[model samples]
Target chain A: MDDLRGGCTLELGSMTSALKAQKILGTAAIPATVVKTSASGGGRGCRYGLRFSCSQMANVRMILANENIRVREAEWKDGS
Target chain B: MEGRELTYLDNAATTFPKPRRVIERMNDLMQNSGGNPGRSSHVLAIKASETVFECREELSDFFGAAGPEQVCFSLNATSSLNFCIKGLLHRGDHVLISDMEHNAVLRPVYRLWRDGVIDYSVFPTFVLEDDGRKTKIIHGILSKLRRNTRMIICSGASNLCSMTMPLAEIGELCRREGILFVVDGAQCAGHIPISLEEMKIDALCIPSHKGLLGPQGCGAAILGKGVMPKTLIEGGNGINSLEADTSGELPERYEAGTLPTPAIAGLCEGVRTVRALGIERIAEHERELFRRALIGLSQIEGVKVYCPHHEGSVLLFNKDGIDSEELCLALSERGICTRGGYHCSALGHKTLGTTNGGALRVSFGVYNSSYDVDKLCEALREI
Candidate 1:
């Protein structure tokens, strides 16, 4: 929670976006679990593979593009 | 659109922005002279037949053939090649072809080879430093001929890199060997001046859509002297429908179907358009475009161009660290249309050392300009 505080937005390109996300999550590998939340407009259910709560992925894309980041998009694996 | 950038460099495959006169003539013929040619003595039928003859005449004069009647209309270059190779060949006959030949010449030869219809060998063009050295290179093909050699098929100019084959010497060799000499003029028919008599070519298969600026589904083969082939396809010749048999003449003997009258009319207009521009001027314009692309691509860092100092039909190259397909996608996104792949000449890729996949090919045409080449180079640099 301390590492995720301050909303310290760094214009990390797609390359650094994944690294930073992994560091903030404190996981060398993404957890293979589904988490449910009640904040979603739709019925939120368990999701996997770094599941976005709402529009975090879209926000990251906008931030990257706005800052002219030259990063390739991260590959997302399917959750069983 | 003037300020906007858009370039199309894939002319060897097919041409766009077709000649206005060709389109007009096609419309005029369809509206005014719509009838089955030679099927009736009615005015419309006679007019349609006349239109067909006029197109044959146009092709005849374009290629310096003996007469207009010698030109046989077909679907395209592939069908024309089939008519020549399959009709004139048999089991155990030997065929001498070129390495730069497109699939039209290759598939039929291969089919024949697999079926034991013929024995074949392909002579690669010798990369010479000087243009004058082409004569000696031609003699090399002649030296490999066996006694039972039935024909020699070579392209007028390579579809890959615009390189003109030494057809005249090959024609002379075939003439001396008592073998048929066929020239696949798919890339050079209307863009370059050709003479059947002067070159002693036995048959020439050409595409009306490429250099001639005609409709896509039309082509012709200018049959040279002593080129009577056995029937590969049998159908109505329109002239002798009641006979229930194919004719044993030149054009009528080979063209067996309801002829493409409208397309032929359009093709005639295409030939007329090319004739008015002058083939020499057309060739020169395309050559200048090639020269610009070669120079520009060579100047770009990490780009390896593939013209090899020869003024050929296609400009092939690849930028370092980029896949050919990826480069093509990038170019297409930039409105710079090009062909990237093996170009249907898989054998050529192995020889050119691009068999891993292939290289990006930018072929030129009379409609293309130096600015197109510049835009392509600029976009490649950006990538």
Candidate 2:
């Protein structure tokens, strides 16, 4: 997921769930590469984006949506 | 402490009117051996180096570290924490931190989290009260750790308000879980008794200028053998300058460049002062001041004190209609040096439900007396 659109980063509870999200999206198992930036431009809330798989994207979006994040296009240099 | 022209109450920030001996020793060092310690082979350099070693020895004994070499000096708590946390943690590692943490811990962790370097989790230690006093327990923090939780960085005492963590319990849990534990003792070093062995702490970061009553710009991290971090700052360690690259070893591994010899010399004196006065005595003295402030704060009609049920100088509150800043200004106008706002502990304030504007924080030190606390009470009453 390159562009998280209106989606925000969810505070997932455990490492297993976070790892599962990565596996589902086929993204890096760690969220370290993702950059967090607030849409407000005032730097308050946070959103994330990176490259991943369909299952991973769906699971991450579902988790984000659960946390009130609205999914958008995965922001990447090349849309695979 | 009473009837003084200026009453200082921001010891949680940085203590003032350092012990006379601390100042005297620093002055003596500056006058006599102004040599670069751990560098030259001259007697003056050796003497200066000896001062560093002796101070480390005293600090090791003070904190119950395994040896003097385990104590590594840094510029301040922030620097020490950077050495302890960032140096040890790698990408994908999971870290658990308490809700009550200063920016020294929060900034580093947040930066890493934002950079996508590690998985971050916060364990709540909040204890809610009817009167707006939020308390937290250490057990709440320990119970939430998962198998992936690799490290735990905690504040020994809340900076926003004085709430001492169940350090022993948390340390034990970390040991049991095989998690690295780092304690930011900025507020507890000289004001409280911290035994590394008794606490089973992996690392203890302390600010020399705060509780230790040393000059500004001096802090240290006491590392246990179990905890070793990759170097954050690497350069000549002064011990092995003949080598092209820096050596990797205790104390030398973390410290780089020229040493803050003067500040450290002052810290040596500060440690001696703490030894002479005894940290237990200091704790007892601060408790008296805290008790007075708590009693007076309780009497105030619209004030709410935020600290643990135990004794300490962390006096946190918000008045009926006054903002934390306004109250702090009001107290300052009365010649009381108290800290307002989040105290660089935004996470702490958030967990305590005072994140909007934070709370007015008044921390005490050994130099503080019952009279200084009384003055704070009087000011709060007027507000």
Candidate 3:
């Protein structure tokens, strides 16, 4: 697993949307990887999100929005 | 007989020997992507969600739904019927149903009528001539239509008798009269080809576990344009969490809580298999089996077979002086499986004139062969 520190993670509502976002971002040449949402980060049940470089974060969000995929939230992890 | 291979003839209840790919896909999903679909974002969750989406797309294409989003998954055909019937009907609304409807459609309507929520009437059973069955049935249905009629709910094919309903004609009638047409496709979805748009069906409820050759615990309802049913269950749809009401999206509005992702995955593969095999080919095979069974059973003395003239793969009959339940037990002892009794379709029994004693139902599927039919006839003869 690549260290996603300093990258922006786009939390999606469902796994289907997350995969769609990943596919769209990949097609757009924006590198992104789907990872499990942290248990404590949300609540119960499995969740997924896409992690991408902070430089392409705005572009990724815009593309997902264009596709009508809902983004639950986005969190930026700070490097320790 | 105890050691002989068991012959399964109760395909109407649920299909056995599901396509190999369906089983494999379900197992793979369970092993690799057993996550709650549509509830979160993660690798496994995304895979699970994609599986569900693929299923919806396959079902939408197969059923001629407007889009994948218009297909909503449920527990079974009964659940889908409940969602459609209970969601769409209001107080004093009139519904027209066929005399051959299974309990899945009849019971819900009866309950609603009992509670003063809706009213419904059963179409009279018309005597079928060689070439006028469809016309007579259509006339019977049209005559029962009242001014307050809001919708028409019927089965694609009768589960008890294998008699297929005239869905296209009924759909046209509903369209011209501005009445909604809802079809319960529990016995016919994968066995017969249906074009939801071409047929003008407003809503179609299907069970994947039956002719679709999928595992149990998963079904779907396809909604046409401008057909919106009230939400049957209110819970988390993973959208609009801040608000109190459920999401108003096509499927999300109807689907609440975690979906059966693994089952949906299996259903996708099942639909794929059906497409590959082609529904026409499957129907031809089952028709042949039904023909053979009818011939074999009709030859036996004291056996009165009902619904022998239908084109579908179901056959209903009873032996003289033999109770249906006792006949079923005898067949079971001889390593044969056949469904006997009311078959959860009291109205169908009445339509077939078998209300005094429920008939024995032998339904053929893709896996059935002439050998199974021969074995069944032999068992019947012995009894």
User: Which regions of candidate 2 deviate over 4 angstroms?
Assistant: A1-80, B1-4, B129-143, B242-244
Judged by TM-score, which candidate is best?
Answer: 3
Clashing pairs in 3: A47-B40, A47-B41, A47-B42, A48-B40, A48-B41, A48-B42, A49-B41
Reference-based lDDT, residue B288, model 3: 93
Model 3 alpha-carbon drift over 4 Å, by segment: A1-80, B1-4, B125-129
| Candidate 3 second chain TM | 0.97
Give the per-residue lDDT digits (tens) of candidate 1, residues A1-80: 12222122221211112223333333423221111111221222111122332324455445436544333332232231
The share of true interface contacts that also appear in candidate 1 amounts to: 0.00
In model 1, the runs with Cα more than 4 Å from the true position are: A1-80, B1-5, B128-133
| Model 2 per-residue lDDT tens digits across residues B1-383 | 35347899888888887888888888888998898665543567656666777788788888999867678899999999988888888888889888788889989999998999988888876544323232244555556677677889988887776567777887887788898889999988887788898999999999889888899988999999657788888786643344455553467667777778889988888888888898888888887888888888888898876654657767788887888898888888888988888888778887788977778888888878888888888888876
Which tens-of-lDDT digit does each residue in B1-383 have in candidate 3?
A: 43236798888999887888999998988887697777655566656777888888899999998767678899999999999999999888999998888899999999999998888998854523446778887888888889999999989888887678788998999999999999999998998889889999999999889999999999998999779999999998765565677754577768888888888888899899889988999999999998888889889999988867786778888999999989999999988888989999988888778888798988888888999999999989998
Rank candidates, DockQ, best first: 3, 2, 1
Scored on chain A only, each candidate's TM-score is 0.29, 0.31, 0.79
lDDT minimum window of 10 residues, candidate 1 chain B: B239-248
lDDT of each: 0.72, 0.73, 0.84
